[model samples]
Target: MPDQAERLRELVRHWELRRKQTRRTIAVASGKGGVGKTNLTVNLALALKEEGRSVTLLDADLGLANVDVVLGIPTTYTLAHVTRQEKNWQK
Candidate 1:
């Protein structure tokens, strides 16, 4: 169990290092609903992609998930699946 914990820590550290090496990160957040946070995030991702930038938009709105709907993309899995160990992020 100690070895597994160490491995997980190492993996987290590696990802943190990689994130630090990235060029930019954009986080769209809102304290209230009825705002265009999802739309803005989607549009920003699209604009960044159009400019030839690699963009990974994580729809973390667990309560009201609609980013996939707005983008017309269907998702078979979500963070819940990953948390429940039903799906792997690599997949």
Candidate 2:
């Protein structure tokens, strides 16, 4: 029932109280294709971001990496770019 700003403040307070380094890794994988893994991952990232948590979505499907396609964003950099040292992970 709280507004966005209030909810974010609550999250900030919660994090401040905890003050512990917490990290989570979620992987969406299925033996079959066309199972909406990318869609679910993208939605989860968006929801986490809305909750004021930093989210990074990495599509490791080297065969057909299409997270950018689902997000409708042009791919300017990728894992290859990072590996090649052309781009850094912070970017």
Cα misplacement distance, residue 23 of candidate 2 (Å): 1.7
Query: What lDDT tens digits, residue by residue, belong to model 1 across residues 1-91?
Result: 4788899999999998897568886888889996999889999999989977788888877778888899898988887888899998776
Per-candidate clash tally:
0, 0
Q: Which candidate number maximizes lDDT? A: 2
Pairs clashing within candidate 1: none
Cα lDDT of model 2 by residue, 1-91, tens digit: 7899999999999997675457788988998999999999999999989988878899988678899999999998888888789988886
The candidate 1 region of ten consecutive residues with least summed lDDT is 19-28
Which whole-number lDDT from 0 to 100 does residue 32 have in model 2? 90
Instruction: Give lDDT per model, in order.
Output: 0.85, 0.88
CA lDDT, candidate 2, residue 62: 67
